[model samples]
Every structure is written in structure tokens, then in C-alpha cells.
Target: MRRRKLHNLQEEFINKFLETIENNEEYLEFINRHKPELLSNCDIAIREVKFFDVFNNTQLNNLIKGISNLNKEKYSIDLSLMSKKYKDLNYLIIQYDNSSTRSLCEVTFKDDLFINNVRAGFTQINNNQAVVEFSISFKEIMTHNLWIDFIKENKELLYGKKFFGYYNIGEMIKSAHFALIYNSISKVIDAALQAKLLSVFSLNFGNEYTLPQYNAIHVPQEHFKKEYFDNMFLCRTYEINNKYLIVDITSDEGLKMDLYFSGLYSSINFLQLLARYRMDLYYFLFEKIERFEINRRVNKYFLNSRKRIALKDYRWLINKIRSLNDNKLRENYTDSRELLEDWKSFYDGKEEEFIDFENGQYTKKYNTIYSECFDHIKMAYSIQKENLVIYIATLSLIASLIGIVTTVLLG
Candidate 1:
């Protein structure tokens, strides 16, 4: 794409990384050795792979411990973990001492597949839900035709069709395929669950594709060329659907550094965005009382003390929704912010309509939910106060009668 650069910081960072690669003797030698194959055959270079999955936080502490143990046992290395903090004022309301931190573990593989480095992590979204992310870096070179074939095959695999093939890794005698890569991921998830780290209610796998800078100027297909690259910022071609995200950068900018960073950031952020949306929907539905059932439900909420317990849960839900909504699009960079907002709008179902569907409904529903909770809690308190008054009055009468009887007996 040939659009204006979104931000200078991104450009500078990408350029610096490219410069480092150029200056490194090992990288330069590898480039020179593969120059012929790279120039003549490779149309699209698959630089990285990222996968995200959501899980329920059944045993959050155990899950973290399990992840740490898994890394130590499997990779023989400690987890490279860090907490992602939001300094935005909006986040201050939601921040708590025990808030879940993002924990990460890096695993490197040799002679297995095109993938070399894999970093996996999890971020707890709410008290009950969490998301695990996998970022894989690849050094695979593929012809333009092979690239197209891979995309097609991958799409089928994503949609639940089984297919397998092997790709030669440079001059190595052994070859690796996508099946092995996917199998490894499945094993990790299975192990986590089997070991009772975390119980999962549902699981979804999402993918992000980062093409090398060389393909930015020369997109493989004419349609994609017209759709993505024509008069758009190289980074602006952040195409996302329910299935996958395609992130690219301009050739002149540098190597695929921007791709690596942005892809990871966007994939993780988008998953969070989607998770929050689903949570909002789920909470709304869980608490929603239909008009026909409103009277019965209200009575149940008021008279039945057990049903009133949901009021506390409702309060928690309100706080969670507010935190998630307020914390959207907190990124400082323009491209990242824009991409997240775009993805939010897409998942929020605001793309086609004139009205903001998700946010508008959110505001209205939130107000209704807040008001309902307030009224129910207030009524419950009032009933308790009335009962206390009656109890005190009855006790006073009993005491007076006892005093009168004692005085009569004394007289």
C-alpha cells in the first residue's frame, strides 16, 4: 500500500531493526547465500505465526503455576513474564492489587518446522475468563504459488477440514508441515487442561499472517493488489475477519520488524476486544428478564433471599463492563489505535448501520441494569429496616408488660 506513514515512531523502530539485520554478519551471509532463491522464486515470505485462544479461569493460580512448570520442564528455561499496565486515567478505576498479570513463556524449536521461536502467554480478562496467546516466528521461504497454496490449505484447515503436506526447510533433509505445528499447540492446551491448570468452557483458535516486506510492493494477486496496496499505508493494510488478520509493511521501511510487533499487538488486543464484547453480551443475556417474566422475576429477586444474591454479582458485572468499555483504544500510536478501533467497530456490529449498535445498546442496557440493581438493593434494605423496627417495637411491649406485672406483684 502507498499511503502516508501513520506514525514516525513505528517507522524509526522498523528502520533500526532492519539496520541491525543488515549489519549482522550472520544475517548478511544467510541473505547472500539465499539471494538467488529469494529473488527468483520467493514471492511471499511467511515471517511469523500468531495464535490466540480463550479459556475459563477455573483455577487461575494453578493455571499460572502449570504454565511455569510446563516451561521449565519442556524448554528448560524460566518464563519471560511481564505485566502490561495501562497508565491511562480510565484504567485507574479498574486497577486492583490482585488484578491478573500477563504471564509469558518462550519456547524455541529446532528442525521441527519453519518456526524457530514461539512465545506463549495468558492474560486474564475477568474473574472467570482468560486468553492464551502464541506468537511464532518463522524463517520459511516460499514461492508465490506455494504461498497461495498454503493460504488456501490453511483456510480449509481452519474450517475443520483435514489436510497435510510437507515443505522443505532450506537444504535440510527433514521437512516440517503445518500439521505438526498445529499438533504441538493442541498438545499444549490438552496438557494444561489434563493437569487441572485451567478448566475450559470453550476454545477458539485465531491466526495472524505477517508477510515479508518484499511482497508489500508486489502483492501476489491483482485483486489483493488493488484491494490492499493501492494508495494505502503499508501498515494500513491490516485486513481482519472472523478467521484471521493480515498485517504488512512497506518495503522501503525495513525488514518485517513492524510486522512482528504490530501483528502480535493487534492479535492480542483484538482477542481482548472480542472477549469483552462477548462478555458484555453474555452478562446482558444472563441478567435479562423478559417482559412476560418481569413480575415473577422481580418478586423472586425481592422475596427470595437466595435470588437477591445475584444483586452482588450484578454489581460486579457493572464494574467489569465499565472497566472494559473505558479501557478501549488506549494505545498511543496512531496506527495501533486506529486498527483496534476498526476491529472493535467490526466486532461490535457497527460496520453497516448508521447507529452505533454495540455501544449504544451497551449504554442503554448498562443504565437499565444499573437502575434495576439499585432499586432492588434499595428495596431489600428498606424491607430489612422495616422488619428491624417491628422487632424492636415487639420487644419494648414485652418489657413493659413484664415491668407492670412485677410492680403489681410488689404492690
Candidate 2:
């Protein structure tokens, strides 16, 4: 049997609906502007990407070998896309879909790593921050379970024991159809990435999702709802109105439709944007913790009572507290006008955590300083008053003695 090439299928698929889908000049222009730059350094521009550290020679070699060993005549998991490489990463764009429209289930999980591209945004985490431009009407659906089994076989040989929980292939069999893209990635990558490949998937799909009874982790059905996705504002979904450029998908509730897009090529950029602020929030937390630690240590020293705290020391402590004020940074990040309202909202929410940290820890520190300083000031005043009183008493006693002596002499 002559195997149909995925490129031919993609061309046919795009051409069939090309007239309706290609009408968006704005989106087309956007793609045109960025596509060249994104694809310039690579041989295969349409392949999926897998990232690896340059130092992980063992993992990288195994990945390349797996791709080399694939039987070209078999399933639609195209090996051609995996041929290209740039630096320590490989691009393996999937041109085939293995899941049906009615089959894909709605899932809700918080995955920080899936969209985390903060180091350099698009330039750095390109391996993990990918755009899966898929249309729901698959020209072919391969056995997703077969690909899953392929990943399980690589548990020891490719991924090793440290990444066992990460490769937890068991969790994926439930949504096997929709998740095949990730599962295929597990096997196709021989060894280039050092844990990040699995990390990307684990971070993407690990926490919240509903699988069929065959694969359920026992989440109650009543708890799941479409409203859950409303809170997932950070999640970017693009739909194809027409057949050519538009991507298609089915809702977990069994609704079938092409995903519509206002012309953002991918959510990778959005992920990067949020990642920047997420990094800021993380640093903010780190600083707050450090301030708390410093306050604790200083309060302990003040409690000792033997060490003298002077007026100047009180001023220094106040200055240190003032320095911990991240008000400006908070204001800058939580800008209402500059950023999207949802992003701004997220920033504000994270900033609240910072405020709570400051309020709780700093309040304790302030009270300790206030009590210690107040007692020191009061004790100093008392000492001066006691000296004055002693001097007056001595003078009075001398005067009495002088008076008595004079009287006796005169007599």
C-alpha cells in the first residue's frame, strides 16, 4: 500500500477551504511578517519543536536515533517534520490529527510550564511554547493508544527514572485521542532535551482534566463545568472560520466547530507576556520573604535588651522597612491602562499576595521596633530626672550643715 504523504494531505486540506479561510488580510499580513523570521534559520518550517540543553548529549542522541528508526510506511505520525534542528532543539510539527471532533474532552489544569517563556520569551522557550494549528476534521486519525504504548516503551531507555512521574503515561490514556500530539513527542524525541520535554507536557496536562472511566483519576462529574474555562482567561483559543487558514476543534461538551481567531498566530506570545509578570511576582515573593527573615532576626536582637539601640538605630530600622516597599514596581506591573484588563487583574491578584506578605510580616516588625524604642526613650528620661533630684538633695543637706555651724560659732 502506497502511504499518502502528510504534505500532500495538508496541501489538499488547505486548498479545499483556501478561498474562505484566506480572506483575513490582517491575519495573513501578521503571519507573513513573522513567519519568515520564525522559520528562517530552520530547514523544515512546519515541524513541531522539541528543546534540549546543549550539554545533555545522552538524551539528545537517543531522540535523534528514535526518529531515524521510524518506519515511514506506517501511521500518520510523520517523521519528516522531525528532520530539522536549530542549536539544541528539534522542530517536529505534526500535520496530522488523531482525535475526532466529538472525542476531545474539556480539561482544566493550571500549567505554568506549558506557556512559560520568560527567560527570553519566544526566543528562549520556543521548544515548549508552541502553536498547534489544528483543524478538527482530520483527514486521518491514527491509533492514539499505539503512540501511547510507544512512549511507555521509552520509560527507562530514553527518559530514565528521575522523570518517571513526569512521563506518567498512565494519566494520558484517558484523553489519548486529543493528547496524542504530546504522547508522540515523548517517543519521537530520542534524547536531546534534559527533562524539559516531559516538563512541558507535565506542566501542560498534569493537574486538571477529565478522562473517561477507563482513565479517570476519580474527579466527580458534578464539579466540572464550562464556567471553569471562563476563569481560564490566560488561555488563548483561536478558531478557523473558513477552511484554509482557520484551525478547527471540538468542545469537550460534544460541540463541533472551527476555532475562530481575531488573528493572533499563536498563544506563545501571550504566554511570554504573562511569563514576564509571573517572573516579577516570583521575585516579589522572594524579596518579601527576605524582608520577613531580616525583621525576625532584628526583633530577636532587640529582645535581648543587653545590646543598646540608640535613636540613630531606630532611624536605620525605619529606613530598611521603607526600602522593602515595592510599591512602584507593583504599580508599574499592575498598570490598568498599559496592559490588558485580564492581565492587569492577574497582576493585581498576585500583587495582593505581596501586600499580604508585607502587612503580616512588616506589621510585626514595626510593633517590635515601636515597643523597644519607646521603652529606651522612657528609661533615658528617667535616668536624667533621678540625677537632678540627687543633686538637689545634696545641695539642701550642705546648706543645713553650714547654717548649724555658723549658729554654734556665734554662740
Candidate 3:
């Protein structure tokens, strides 16, 4: 069989992913609804950062201090350093990386628009995970038509494209404004990576062309028809595999755009959802790592032992498989056990969108990896148990033979 290239594998994965989503009856029905001509009057951008690990003690402290000083001196931004501890759905403190110490910064993008807050944080337990969150919002009150033009003009930025040419919002203004904010955020991240404060790994599909992000749009209540669900093209942009959650807010009583986007409770809920999604990505990556590790160990075991593999060596493999299962079953920062329940309460009976969002992201894929890992663990445990019984029976036979020899010699 000919070996396939990495790019080919990525292309295949992407194709299969799109096929699965596009073929879903619900998704198809939702997409087939009458496409809305209405556009958003305001837009919000949420970017998710997944850091594999963070530095320890001195190194971490220095990086935080350096970034804080740089933010004040160069970006004219104040930094707030705080510790946050989150409890799971049952109000129990999660055992894995439950607390995070983060530094927050706020920047004003323009007179009315703001890049509300940017956070860079690391977990307290082993510093195994970190999250960076930031959002951009346009505060100008514009007519729906003007907002449509605004989205059209700034599509490049909204879509998270790195570069583009000639937008109606004045090429210079578009470039300068976004570039300044992006660069400011990028500088902090770059510094962290350079200082070894955080580390990240690339997925098999390769580096994403654009940042992982979600968009929130405020549309008029009359325009928030079922057809708007099919507007995924504009919300997702050209990144098929990088589809993000698009939340459309209307002017209904509790669903008011202003309150949904700006209310304290709503903001916190949005942050929780974002955090959960980030953690989901983390689990997906961790599972891939574990799967690769298991395969590598299995291959190494066969190659190194050939035909003389010891029982102890087998025991090591069994222990490793058990460890993998233990890690998978351990409680994490996000409590997925009650994810649906929490999302239902938060969305106020609109949990379908959340479900779709998770499915679109990596929830289904994560479950697939999890099931694969579980199978491996199960097989390893079965083998271990069988070997243990055989070893015990062999020892019993040897003892009986020794006892019979002693009796024969005495006779």
C-alpha cells in the first residue's frame, strides 16, 4: 500500500467532517429555510486560545510580570491580576486544574468600539492548561442596512483573516485599527511563547489558517426568522472545519440584544460556554496524544521483546493502559456531566443551538476518540487478568510437584 501524505489525510478528514454535518437531516432542514435578507446591527467576536502547558513558579511569575509591565508601558493598558476558582455543576471543586490565576487587560479600539477584555491565564494544578480570551465589539448604533454594509466591509477582520486589500472602511483605517489591536494581543502571546511560559502543539490537520472564534450578532426581532439559521456561510466564512458558534440576539423581552450582550449574567454565561468549549478542545487533543502514546508503546513492546517479552514488561503495559483510563475518567475544569442541563438553563429553552454548536465543533469527534481509548483499555485489562490467572495456576502446579518430590524422597 502506498503511504498517504499528511495533507491528503487532512483533506480526507475535512471532507468526511463536512459530509457528516451536511448530511444530517436536522442540519439540512435548518439550512433550507428561507435565507434572511436582514443583517446584524452589532457584532461581537470571541477568540479561544488553547495552551497545552504553562511554565512553573519563577518562570511563570516573571512572564506575568513582564507582560503586565509591557502592557502598561507600551499599550497604555492596566492589568488586573486575580485568582478564580470554579466549582462544577454539583458545586464540588473539580480535582483537575480547578483554579486559574489570570491577568486581564482592557483596550478601547475606537471612540465607540472596544476590545472589551483580554485574559491570559494558567491553571494552578501542574500548570497543565491555560486559556486566553478576548473579545471585540462595535458599539455604534447603526441602522440594519448600515450594519449590513459594515459587516460586508469588515468581513475580512470579522472572519479573522490576517491580511486583505481595499475595504470600504478606508483601507488605512481598517488596517491600522485592527492591526494595532491584533498586534497588541499577539505581542503578549508571542512573549509568553518565547519565554516558554506556555506551549502548544499542532494537530494532524495542521495549523489553522484563522484563529478559532465565535461571532455574536444583534438582529432585529422581526428579522430573526428561522431562515437566519442558514446564514452559516457569512458566520462561518471560508473556514469549513473552523466553523464557530454564531449567536444571533433579537429584541424580544428576555432576548434583547443589548441585555444579552452586555448584561453581567449573560456575559458570565458566555464566558462559561467559551471555557467549556476550550476545555473540550483540550480533551480532544489529550485523547489524540494518549492514543498515539498507546500505539507507540505497543509497537515498541513487540519490537524490543521479539519473542522473549517478560511478564513484568506486560505488567508495565497493563499499568500504562490503566493510567490512560484513569486520566480520561478524572474530573476536569469543565463538568461535561451537566453540560446539557446548564446550557438549557442558560439559553432559556434554546438548547438546540448549543447542541448544534458542540456537534459542529468537536463533541462528537471527542466521543469517538474516547470510545477508541476505552476499547484499548478494556483489552489491556482483559489480557492482564487472563495472564494473572495463568501465572497463579502455574505457581500452584510447581508447589505441588515440589511437595510430591519431598514425599517420595522421605519414603
Candidate 4:
């Protein structure tokens, strides 16, 4: 969470990765010959943490109270006394008392960072319907080379691990519940999720001297003047728009300030929250996939209804974004306008890709349902027609018999 240590580690990793690649003769020759300016911009990778257990409003309230009154054990959940039906105890929200630490994440919730603002609870996610979420965030400034295995490596870190819930391993208690199952998750182990890392490769590398190398990105000079800030020496801002500003510092100290100001301290926070849209997309596909594999007799009506509901939901969401983008909600981010634009392009492109994928998936499923239903209808119609033909023949034969009998009697 401390800036200096993270900065040094990233610097070391980048240099190590690049230097190690010297063993690759072809790559070395190409870089030497070409003298290519290899600069990778910083990237922020947002990750999500979720639990499958569902918590009703009452349970959510109970958890909130327990977190609020951390000094008391009265609200502490007793595993033995609770119902067997109760699975894992999950937190919809955890509001640590006035002692909770504050950081960039607090800014996302519009809370002050220096003081522990108990009002701003750490949120792993913005969704109030969550089963449990402990949102803790900090930043990483990585070079492109480091990304080769940086994320995977980061996952193994116990950097900021903390126990947020209750547990007693003594007295044959394996967890918060069911000793045999021992699967009760009152603790979110290895809690830090590597939500995002910002890579710092410059788009314009050669012009490092004339102007700030990181200052290659341009915006209209009128909006974001460097002098507009309270302490110009601490950081610089390049205008992205009326609402958005870009960080324009060339040094680590400068980047730190840029990270704070342009990042709005909570930029990653906002992003992590927005990232939930992805969860919906994944869940929708997951449900359909499960249905296909597990349910042998998927009904036509259910398929049709699902198809319509998904289409409508996506359409509404897309339209909502369009409306927002029309006027455009403005926010700023670090090190050049290019980095900010990259985030926008990344989000927009992914949104479109996901929507397109869902449309294709649901469309295919609906067609399968319709085809099966149509075949059944056709078979039923054929059977009814055959019965009608047999009935007509029987009536004609009876009439013929009656006519013959009448003729004989008359003669």
C-alpha cells in the first residue's frame, strides 16, 4: 500500500525482465539494430471477489452491526446455535468502526483518506446485494515486460492479508460451522484481489528531452492548465475534457501525485464498481451453458423467455451508456491522454464484444427451442388429419348399407 516500495519493486521487475531477455539473441539483435523506443504505458487491472452464498436483508444487517460494534462480542455469530440450513456466513457489507484505515479506495466512495472515515466502508464491490465483499485497493505501476507473469505472481502474495471475520479453531471447531465439512468460510483467506495494475509505457518515446516524454498526449490548452492546481510543482495535469484531466509528470514522485489527483484517488474504485457489468455478462452465459449441459429437456417457452429478457436487458443497458456518453461523464487519469483513452477504448470495445457474444449465444439457443417445438406441432397436425379421413369413410359405408336395405324392402 505504501507508494515508495511498490514503485521500487516495479522498477526492479521491469529491468530484470528486460535484462533477462538478452539471452534471446534474435530479440537482442532486433532491438539493437532498430533502436526501437520501447515504452509501455501503465495499466490498471481490476479484479472481483464474490461468494456464492446468499444473504437476506436480516443477515446482512446482522453482519453490518457486528462490524460496526467491533468492541463487543454480543452480536458475534455462534455456529452451534444457528440452524443447520445456514451455510457460509457472508457479508453484504462490512463497516469497520472509526478505526478502519483509509486510502485511495475511500476517495472512490467520496471519503477523506487521511482519517478513518467509518462512513465509507471498504467495499469489494458496489453492489449492495453482495453476499460478502471486503474492498481493499492500492496501485501497481508495471512495465510491459513485467506483465508476462506479473499478475499470476501477484496472486501468490499475502501482502495485505487481514482477518475480517470471527473464527475459533479450538474446541474441535474447524471453522465457523460443520466440523466434518470444514468448508465454512467465515474468513476470506488471502484476501487481496489484484484488481488492476497500471502499465507506464510511453506512446511517444524519443521526445524524452524536448518536452516531458510522458507529455506526448495533447488536449485543448484552455481547460487543464498546469497552473490551475494548488501546488503545480507536485503534479501536472493535461486536459482531457471539461470533466476529465490527464496526469503529466515525468518522475516517480510526479507520477505519485498524478496518480492521486488525476486518478481522483478513487478512479480505480469507480472502475472496479463499473466492472460489475462484466459479471452480468459472464453469469448470463454461465446460466445458458449450465442449462444446455445439465437440463436434457429445456422447454421452448423458457428458452424464448430467456432470449427476450436478455435482449431487452442488454438493449436497455447499452442505451443507458449511449445516453451517458452523449453528454459524457468526465474523469481524469494518469500519465498522458493516451492512457486515459486506452481505458475508454478498452471498456467500450469489451462492452460491444460481450453484447455481441450474448446475442449470438441466445439467438442460437432460441432457434434450437423453436425448431423442436415446430416439429412437435407438425406431427400432431398429421395425426389429426389421418383420423378425419377414417371417420369420413366409416360414415359413407353406413349410408350405403341403409340405401340397399330400403331398396330391397320397396321391391
Name the candidate that leads on TM-score. Answer: 3
By TM-score, rank the candidates, best first. Answer: 3, 1, 4, 2
Q: How close is candidate 1 to the true structure, as a TM-score?
A: 0.36
**Model 2, 1-411: lDDT tens per residue?**
122343343333223222212343543454456564423211111112222121123333334444444344421232222333433444322211111111111111123212222111111111112211111111222133332343333323332222222222333333333234222342232221223333322221111111100000111234323333223333322211211111112222111111112222232222323223322222222333334434544554446643544446455455434322322233244332233322211121122223222223433454465556546545654665788799899999999999999999999
Quote each prediction's TM-score.
0.36, 0.23, 0.36, 0.25
Off by over 4 Å in 2: 1-143, 146-150, 157-160, 166-225, 228-265, 268-278, 281-331, 334-338, 342-411
lDDT of 3 by residue, 68-158 (tens): 4443332444445532223111111233323434444444323222222234433332222243443333344333334334333332222
Off by over 4 Å in 1: 1-77, 80-337, 340-360, 396-400, 403-411
Clashing pairs in 3: none
Q: Candidate 4 versus the native: TM-score? A: 0.25
lDDT of 1: 0.37
Sorted by lDDT, highest first, which candidate order results? Answer: 1, 3, 2, 4
Per-residue CA lDDT of model 4 for 353-393, tens digit only, reads 22222223533453354455445434544655677789898
User: Which digits, one per residue and each the tens of the lDDT, describe model 1 over residues 95-134?
Assistant: 2212233545666544433335566565544444555655
lDDT of each: 0.37, 0.30, 0.35, 0.29
lDDT of 4 at 306: 31
TM-score of 3: 0.36
Instruction: Supply the global lDDT for candidate 4.
Output: 0.29
